[model samples]
Target: MKINGFRGRLITADHADYDTARAVWNGAVDRRPRLIARCGGSADVAAAVRFARDHDLEIAVRGGGHNVAGTAVCEDGIVIDLSAMRAVRVDPAGRTARVQGGALWGDVDHTTQAHALATTGGIVSHTGVAGLTLGGGIGFLMRAHGLTVDNLLAAEVVTAEGDVVRASADEHPDLFWALRGGGGNFGVVSSFRFALHPVGPTVLAGPIFWAADDTTEVLRFYRDFAAEAPDELGTVVRLGTVPPLPAIPAELHWRPAVAVICCYAGAVDDGERAVRALRRFGTPLVDLLAPTRYAAFQAATDDTVLHGWHYYWKSTNLAGLSDDTIAVITDHAYAARSPRSYSAMFHMGGAVARVPQDATAYAGREVAHNIIIDGVWLPAESGKHAAAETAWARRFLQALQPHRATGVYVNFLDSDDDTGRVREAYGDRTYRRLAEVKAKYDPDNAFHHNKNIGPG
Candidate 1:
């Protein structure tokens, strides 16, 4: 608390906000940091890092606190909390935005939408920008623009030695490359500079759902249509019960279904035409596809996956949806212990697939989709409910393993994941390169709390 050069508030066990400060997005993670350093800027972050090193205390860096893995908080370490620094500055002229470490996708979307400029971000608006970008962020705009890291111009990082440095294409190029999809093993990202693209004030976006019996037909159509769909049209398939929302038909609320969530980043009229075939393909239970404010559409699923829920997630990359794979997922989709839980598949192509695999540490550039099975349960529905709910996700993932590609998405993994899972995220080549970068920056492994890539 008395460390010099650290000009930020520190919360201890006895502090009034200690309990709230330690909470993460996943209610399952209950950790108590010995000290929570509410960082105001890079200086505070650096000082906190140095203070932890000097005291032989472990360090956990908190940025948006939405990793679900709960690496944001440590059992008895120092948490360099960046929640207080949620400033976003947009440069419309340069087509870029500078975001603080703790800023969420909603913060970025709201600011960038004001200029009709945006970047690829998380599907869930409240997801952390830092964590998502580092793990190759994918969303509705990914096919149109690219992964969040593809647009990442630079980052200001606080290294293990407490040095503040900038990583970019021209400066610390290797570090910049690693930060793109290497997860947060390097350091605490104080701020990020991202290249933005012209998106929309209004875009054609929403979900179209079909009845449970139509899962096979809808999924096959989704696979075919997505494969040939234009880059401007982004698509995702969710096989689960419908979320109860105002925009949805009350008659179809909580009904088991297969749905296509669409987003077109171009002119609304063009978007309408682009997805007309999909909208008319089936006897839909509910079709909410229409022109919507871009930022609002980005947050469409916010309530369904709200914070403070006990969350379990497992996911993998795939070349495409095989019939066997489809059958396996559909069989388990509606059987989730929690009605709110779902199995999801995100279409990956366009700008995402065009990038070379070796271009960045992100390993899934060649894959066609990313499949995620999420088990969600509320606090009151935890205990035995949590175990049963998570078992569903685990089994769902296992059943589809034979159909999955070589690697997993590092971002989807939780704290309990073994080192093999981390290695599986990036293959031998990328993993070795990341380990070398980690050795040069954080040999002592002070930042090992995350989905770690250790020192070589």
Candidate 2:
């Protein structure tokens, strides 16, 4: 079990930390890898990859280990854990951040905020930058900036062939293109260089909620308003039972509600003007919209969405929020198997659509809403409610099929068996190109743990 040229901790099943090391974000996944290489840097990562290949071991790469599908851990294989390699170097003059692959959104946010700079990142602070960026990241900055992939300037990757290489617009441009939205099928990215924008230490952001009974009117207003809203105003509508948090009014706890979480990534004056209309609409049960620190706003939902939750998420690109689509969503939201489960409708028209469809590996550029159905249940009661939650999500997705676009977000897909779904995520032409890229980079499909595009 010697990993030649390796200079990192190697853990086997007998190791004291084996059980803890194997745990990922999804509580439902309980895998025990034959070996876990706690990679320290690019050299450790390269050595681990080579070890996995030479030993005929299936490879699983772990960054922040936040993938809902639990692709970061594998049973009876080699796990290249990059958790130890988190280093964020921000070049204030260049307005860019060179981040190690294992860094999370929180890590990047903390560093970039010191210079009053930022980039598109996941809503949850703990979500991995690498996975989310590779899978086409969507976040509060999406409207103002773009997907995380769009902000990505360059990457240093260790290919499946065990070679270290750099991919960027000026060097290995095709590989760079693939790295943007293509999943980890090509190689193990050791670090990323992201082009940062002048965002804020503070911005106007938070949630405005109405009773579920007001879903129809609230949605209608949102449909028309968000479509034409300024790029700086990023809004997302969530339909779910309110969690019993201290922030919520005591009476409103566990109540069914339709909420619009808004983040205006611009001047306080402009942001106030932008969100004024949304704030005025409908009889809101709760309106927490206010000027807040960008870092605080980004990590606001961290408490509710902590790790080790059983999550089954299904997503589709919506043509638009038509009347029928709204009705279907409302009905399913009310019938959710668990109160923790909810549906999210992200308003994605501004900067996201400005990028052409073929500019990167990401699909569904022109779509209006990114619809995600999150089916969640406590792992402690998984035996009692897991099946019901998953079934509910599937049925809800099926109900929305008529209103769904042909493409879906690959990262949001949960079912591991659905290879056809992966193809649908990218259309025939793009998928074919991805396959060709796979052939050039990883013909053996060494990195098939994600939504794979095998060499055809």
Candidate 3:
């Protein structure tokens, strides 16, 4: 391996720490990179890119290293570790924040909250800003504001030629447009400038749980209710086993239940009124909804799951959840191998749909629901559970055939899954445009860890 005179630590396969460094969030993926460059700054990232290009090595970029497909690390190539470059700067007057590529959502949230501002981010605070935003972030604020990519004002990217350039509406506009919803295909983003919104130090949010037997009815009502819900009200309907938390009764622990996790991004009184109908709609087993800090709501479920757990997730966009789709979801929910596994459906046609299809690379403009079948299991039983989850997800997706969108969300993709599905993620026109951008910025496809669009 060639060694450049860079300041960052370089770990080879021979190093004891190399194995630990290459391991990704998904325990299922076990890749060994030839060298791991622990980057300290943009200069270090540039050097790594240059070295990889010159030596003809495949490169993987690691931010928070939380990619579900374990794309953050690669096999027999160079891994550029950005964990050491985390830094967040907030400009309250400008209502914008500039974040380093390595920074996690937690880091951005904490820094921006100091000024009573926030950018759209993922549900999990542990998710890296770079990967999530680039892949079109959808979260609690999505209804009130928009996807994180929609909030992105500008970015500093390191191209294949090892030159850093700014991409935005006015500068490198085509690259900017492609970067909005395009995965890491265009270039390596070093820093991102995102427009922030006045979210709360406090907001109304929590989960309402119903019995397993009520799954069908709850889903039916939720589908109708969410469609007409105000943009201020964002919700996700989850069917999974009730975890053994203090709030859940002992008898209910480890048993199946249907839950609606709601977040209201408005005044306390208004939120209460907006969610009152849901409280009255069903005889809930538990109602944990109340006023809490926005950050707290975002971080509420963060600790419930651990890293390195086996995960298999499949998703599809829906015009609306039909009766047949609901039936399939309920059936699969009951058949899920692990208590931790779940079938979730989120309403997706508010702020996200407002944008024109050609405004960005994300093509699911008219999609009403975002359905996901997630299987999480212990390493020992992963094989069986993975098979079950894959079968269930495919079955449910096929059942929703009538309401299906042309594509899938890139963020929830599985590495070994269909390349054709990746094409579906971006419609034909967008895919061609993205390919052109890929050629311009990365002709050799150096950054292929994400949902990639090959060079033109």
- For lDDT, the strongest prediction is 1
Residue runs of model 3 more than 4 Å from their true location after superposition: 1-5
For 1-456, candidate 2 gives per-residue lDDT tens digits of 679999999999999999999999988889999999999999999999998998899999999999888999998999999998889999999999999999999999999999999999998899998899998999989988999999999999999988899999998888898988888989999999999999889888889989999999999899889877999998889889887777778999879999999888899899999888888997899998998989988888886767888888888888778999889888887787688888888888788889998989998788889788888888887987788888888888999999987799888988564556998988999899889999999989999988888987
Q: How much does candidate 3 score in TM-score?
A: 0.96
Candidate 3 minimal-lDDT segment of 10 residues: 299-308
Clashing pairs in 1: none
Which residue pairs collide, candidate 2?
none
Q: Is candidate 2 or candidate 3 better by TM-score?
A: 2
lDDT of each: 0.90, 0.90, 0.83
Ranking according to lDDT, highest score first = 1, 2, 3
For model 2, what is the alpha-carbon lDDT of residue 103?
94
Q: Candidate 1: TM-score? A: 0.98
lDDT for each residue of candidate 3 in 223-256, tens digit (9 for 90 to 100): 7788789998889887888777765678877788
